[model samples]
Target chain A: MFPVFEIFGKQIGVYGIMAAVGFVACFLVGRLLIRRYDIDIYDFALTMIAAGIGMAIGASLLYAATNYRYLFYGFSHFYEIGWSGLWMCVKTALDGFVFYGGFIGAAIGILIYTKCAKDVKAHRDHLLDIYAVLVPLFHGFGRVGCFFGGCCYGIESPFGFTVHNNHLNPAINDVNRFPVQLLESGCNLLIFLLLLVLFKKHIMEKRLIYLYLLIYPIVRFSDEFLRGDGIRGSLFGLSTSQWVSIILFIFALVMLPIKTKKLKAQSAQAAESDAD
Target chain B: MEQQQGKKGFAIASLVLGIVACVISWWGLVLGIIGIICAVIGLILAIQAQKSYKAIGQKNGVATAGLVLSIIGLILSIIGTIACGIVCAAGTAIANDSRIANQLLDQISSSVN
Candidate 1:
């Protein structure tokens, strides 16, 4: 529950610290991989920057969408509250963001980066394979941050530790709750390791990204059930993330075969050309 | 070859900036903010370095390390800023509430006396 800590009279957020650590770890690991694969570092840096921007935008937009009441209230009372209030409302809206939105945004960013960068476009499959592993590695750190920040808490459960004075969510306070954040973080780490091993072994080839898409959605779909927070909107009796997971899972399922077939065809053509 | 030499200079500069950013990030919010700015510039330099390296068919590990460190510094600084904001807001709210409570108590005592 230690969201903020002071050092040398300056407050530091644990979540931010963890995220920073994650980003560094991801970058270092990915750099090693880029070297191994002989990928273009400049293109990698550009793609990362694009993805970071996209994630920031997507996360904030989705947060605002899910918490529409805040916007409605702010708009309705805009005249009465004036500029300072409106500014505060905007600040508040930007503070909390959904991870799924960031994920989707990053994917879109990578796609756009690939389209624009000719060198990266040529090595899209390999880059995507690296990205697939990076996502989970970064996300795992984020989950740890969530746990310390006392956000995205799980339902009351006698099996887990009780939280006290949880500043982020009072509902989670004074009750034993499942450590869903830690569980998810652990799961993500496992997935990262698995993907890394598969990648090193050259097991899945170009289908690695699809494998991640297929696997993570299922984990997320089930994990949503354990999640206690309702800040992330719901539709048709399922949370926004759950719905997104289902959609993504289906998309991955459909795209897997198509992409595999396309790759096989391309390879066959290359082989024939080489033979000639 | 000249441009390649210039790129190497950028890579070294980026690496130095990245290290400075990461170190200064822990000092204070103001320093952290400066670190973030430095990190952004460092990242740009690292990218340039990488592009140059690619042109020369060489791998620039220093540029990669610089890019990684810079990103980490930026994230830390941003988090430090948010933490400061939250703490400040909470402090202000508490002070206001205490002031109102003290004023009410003083008024009650004066009236009773």
Candidate 2:
């Protein structure tokens, strides 16, 4: 796991670089999809940027929130600690980020974008379907980055591989662990492909986002069990992400019915008006 | 037209706050904190303006700019705050450590004499 390496005598994180790559890839693919749908490319770009900003804030805030006890302890012991200690505290607080937080943040960003961008506002549902496709596509790359960064690692297994001299998490060093990151990455890629196929076939239409919501939460909940990292925080023997997954899954289930009912009502009303 | 003006006002306010936040972000810790607060408020106002524009079937360029700028300013302010905190903490630690070391040397020398 090569977390950091030098490029032209400058240190760069593999995770950050991969995430950036994923962002660019998402934007490029999004542009293509938007063009195909006859949506304004510029507006798509702006919305994508907004989603990126939201993702950054949401991810960091969730990271900090999950480690709230540590942050509070740091603040409480602020007067007693040296500069190094303070640096460590702040660094830790800023380092780890949760993906669910980013997803929620991006959703908010899209909402804001829909308001701000005229064309996007007019075609919000279509754009959101595209956005749903992009999520797993981007996340797939991010999980690969996590693999390279040696974070979000899996539990020990005889069939797994060992990571040696891992500076990021020394606890996992020399320990044979399940390759959970790779597994998640593979799963995400499959999901991305499945969504793309659904999109192409026009099967779900505006309900694509709901499909993602229904699918991803189950995968995340199951994958959480294989995750070895404790920094994600846990409550009642379930990790934070697991709890979020449960909520998202149930929310999706409830929303699916309501959305179908509303769509039906709208179509019925349109039909009645046409008959008149 | 009146609602449009209201939306414009919020957009302008958001843009101004966003600019101020970015400008003062790197000044100091307190200023960075202020910048962050301003950015957050600007973001909220920008969202409100965007919502208003959507309801009225219009798009406000200024509001979009405000939202984007506010996000930038907020991120910069947060980074600035962390950087400032780290530098000050490191300086204090180095100074305190050196001072303690000096005092210990003086005590040892005086006791020997």
Q: True contacts preserved, each candidate?
A: 0.19, 0.00
Model 1, A147-223: lDDT tens digits are 88777878788777787875655656888889999999999999999999998888878788899999999898998
At residue A142, candidate 1 shows an lDDT of 85
- Name model 1 segments beyond 4 Å from true: B1-38, B53-72, B81-113
Residue A113 C-alpha lDDT in model 2: 83
Error of 1 at A11 (Å): 1.3
- TM-score of chain A for each candidate? 0.94, 0.93
Which one wins on TM-score? 1
Each model's lDDT comes to 0.75, 0.75
TM-score of each: 0.80, 0.71
Query: How many residue pairs clash (N, CA or C atoms closer than 3 angstroms) in each of the candidate models, in the order given?
Result: 0, 0
Q: Which run of 10 residues does model 1 chain A get worst, by summed lDDT?
A: A66-75
Instruction: Report how far off residue A238 is in candidate 2 (Å).
Output: 1.1
Who wins the DockQ comparison? 1
For A129-223, candidate 2 gives per-residue lDDT tens digits of: 89899999989888877777777779888867788876656656788999898899899999999998998888787788889999999999998
